[model samples]
Target: MSDAVKRLAIRDRIAVLDVLRGLAILLILLMNIPAMGNLESARIDVTGWTAADQMATWLQRVIFAGTQRGMLELLFGAGMLIMASRAMQPDGPVAVADAYYRRNLWLVVFGLAHALLFMWWGEILFPYGLAALLIFQFRTLAPRTLMGIGLVVLLASGHWFGTQQYNARQQLLHDAPAALAIKAEGNPLSDDQSATVKRWEDLQASTKGTGKETQEERTGRTTTLAAFFKWNAKFWMGFTSDLLVLIIFEASATMLIGAALFKWGIIQGKRSARFYLALMLCAYAVAIPMRVIDTQQYMTLALDPRPGWITYQISRLAMTLGHLALVNLAISTGVGRWLLKPFEAAGRLPLSVYFGQSIICLWILFPPYGFGLWGKFGMAGMTAIAVGVIAFQVIVANLWLRWFENGPFEWLWKSLAYAKLQPFRKTPSAIHITAPI
Candidate 1:
C-alpha cells in the first residue's frame, strides 16, 4: 500500500479507545466540578463543607482527581507515539515532527479561542500545544532520554509550584486574620467587593475576544482589564508552572509507554487476560489507598501550609505515582474500556466536547445565563447534575459520531490546521469498517 493509504489505515480499536476517552471526560468533570463553589459563591474551595458535600469532595479528590488526569496524560502520550510512528515510515523524524507540530499549533489557536469565548479557563489544549512544540524538537531522542527530560521537567515544575504555593499561603495567612474576619459574616463580599464582582461578571459575559481588537480595546481601556490580567497571570502560573509540569511529565512518559505497548501489540487488543489482570492487581492494590491518604493529607493543608509541609510534599509525589499506577492498571482492565465506550467518540473531538460541556455548564450556572444554578447546587445536587450532564454528553456524542467523522469544533480546528478542508460528515461510502467481525 502507498504511504498515504498506510497513514490513513491502521488497525485501531475505535470502540476501546473511545470508551477510555469517554471515561476520561466524565472523570475530568468529577475532578473539576467541586472546583465550582455553590450558588452563592464563585469559589471552588469545598474544604469546610459537611456531610454529602464533604464526602463528595474527598471521594472525588481521591478517586477521580488523583487518577483521571494521569490516565488522560497517558492516553495523549500514546496518541503521540501512534502519530509519530505513522509519520516516520516514509520520511524521517523531521517529517513526523512537522506534521504533529502543525496539528499542535492549530490546537493552540483553538484552545485560546475556546478559553476566551467560553467561560472555561482550565483548557488543556493550550499547554499540550506548548509541550508538543518543545517535544517535536526532540523527536530523535532515545525513549530513555525523553523519559529523563520528562522527569526533570516534572520535578522542577513541582518544586516551583510547591514553593509558590508555600509562599502564597504564607502571604494569604499573614493577611487572612483581617481579611477573614471582615469577610466572615454571612455576606462574604464587601460592598466594594460585590460591585467589583458584578462588574467582572458583566465583562466576562460580554467579552469573547473574537473581533480583532474590540475585546482588547475594551479591556485595555479599563481598570478591570488590568485586574483581570493580574489575577489571570497568577492563575495561569499556578497550573502551568506547577501542576502542568507534573502532568506533562506524566503524559510524556505515558506516551512512550503507549508507543512501546503499540509496538508490542498490547494496545491492539492482543494482550492476554492474565497480563491485564496482573496489571490491574499491581496498579490498583498498592496505589489507590495510598493516593487517597495522600490526597486527604495534602488537601487538609492546601489553603494554609501546615508544619508538616515537607512530609506532605513528599507524599504528594507518592500519591501522583500511585495515581499513574492506577491509570496503567485501568488501561489493562476491561472495566475502563467498557466504561468509556459512550464517551470515547466524543473524546476524539475533545475540543468540541470540552467546550460544549463548558457552554452547557456555564449556561446552567452563570447568573446572567440560563438557570443561574451555581451556588445553589450543593454537593449532592451538583454531583447529580454532573452525572446527568455526562449522560447527556454520551447521548450527544453517540448521535453526532454516528453521522459525522469529526465533532463540529474538531472539524473546524482541523480544517484550519491543515489549511484545507478534510472529511467531516461520515457518508456511507466514506465509512470504512474492517471486515470479518
Candidate 2:
C-alpha cells in the first residue's frame, strides 16, 4: 500500500461520524415507532386526529420522517468507504474484501432474524446488506465521480418509480367503481381488469383496514411462537415483493453519496465552517420549502401524491446533506464535544442498540404475549415511547462501554468477519500511561 493508504488506516475515529449515527438511530426509532407499535391512525392520514396528534404528525412529516433514514444510509456508505480504505493496506486487499463480504453476509442473517422474530416490517438491515454487496465494487472511485453517478441513479430511479406509482394509483381509482359495477351486475370481468381490481382491493385492505377489526388486533392475537413466525413470514414475503426496487434504489444511491462524502472529508468534520454554513443554508432553503409544499399537497388537496414523491428524492437528499453539514459545523465549532458523548457511545454499538430496540418493542408492544400495546398508542404516545427507548439505550451504551471494548453484537460480528475470536473486555494494560521518569 502507498503512504496514503497507510495514513488512512491509522486515522483516528471521527467523533462526528458516531454522533451522526447516534442521532440517526434515535430519529429512526421516532420515525418507526408508529409502525412498530401498529399505530395505523398515526400515519399521514389525518382522520379524526386530536390537536396533539395532529401536531405530532406534522412534526414527524416535517422533520423526522425520511431524513433520519437518509442520514443512516449516508453514514452506512461512509462506513463502507472507511473500512475499505483500511482494507487496502499492502497485501491486504483480498483479505479485506473477504471480511467485507463476510460482515455483510452476517448482516443479512441478522436482518432476517430481526424481521422474522421481532415482527418488525420496517427492517432496513437486509436491504442495506444487499446494497452494500453491490456498492463495494465502487469503493475506489473518486468522490466527484461517485457523487455524479449516485445523483443520476437517484434521480432516474425516483422519477421512474414515482411515475409508475402515480399511474397505478390513477388506474386503481378509475377501475374500482367500474369493477364494483360489473360485480353488482353479476358479470364476469376480464382477467386483466380483474387483476387491476384485485390490486386496488389489496391496497385498500392494507391501508384502510377490512372494518372487521383493526389490523393490529388481528395480527397481534398470535399467542404462540409458531403463529408469530407464520404471520411474519407471510408479511415479509409480501412486503419485500412490493417494495424491493424502492428499497434497493434508495439504499444504493444514498450509500454512494455517503461514500463520496467520506472521500471528500466533509463527513469527517474536515470542511471549513463557512463551507458547511453555506451548504446548510442552501440545502435547507431548497428542501424545507419543498417538504412543506409536498406535505400540504398530500394532506389537504388529496392529490395524486406522485409529484410529491418525485420531489421527495430531491428534498430528502438535500436535507440529508444539509444535516451532515450542520453536524460538521457543530463539531468543528466545539459545540459537539459535551453533547455528543452518549450519542457516540450508542453509535459505536449501533448493532446492539438496534437489536436491543427490537427486543424491547417486542416485549412491550407486541400483542397477546406482551403488553398488547400495538395500535394503542397515538402519535404523541409513540413519540414518548421512542424518547424513552433512546434515553435507555444511551445510558446502557455508556455503562456497557465503560468495561467492554465492543458491544456484544459488534464483537460477534467482528469475530465472524475476521474468522477469529476477538477480545471483548477492555484491558487495563491497553490504556496508555505517562512514564514515571
> Quick one: best lDDT, which candidate?
2
Report lDDT per candidate: 0.55, 0.74
| Tens-place lDDT digits, model 2, residues 1-437 | 23323212112666678888988886688877776665342224322356776678777777666888899889988988777775544445575677678889888887887888776667888888898888888887888988998899888888888788777788778878888789779999999778977766666554555532245335544456566567667767788998977888888988999999888878777779899999999989988888887766655534254476767788888888888888777766545656665688787788898888878886566565778666566677778888999999999998987788778888887777667776688787433121110
Model 1 ranges off by over 4 Å? 1-15, 36-48, 89-95, 139-145, 163-270, 298-340, 432-437
- What TM-score goes with each of the models? 0.71, 0.88
Clashing pairs in 2: none
Q: What is the lDDT of residue 143 in candidate 1?
A: 59
Q: How accurate is candidate 1 locally (lDDT)?
A: 0.55
- Candidate 1 lDDT over residue span 99-193, tens digit each: 67778888777766655455345667776665556554454455566555655555555556567666755765565455445555655766655
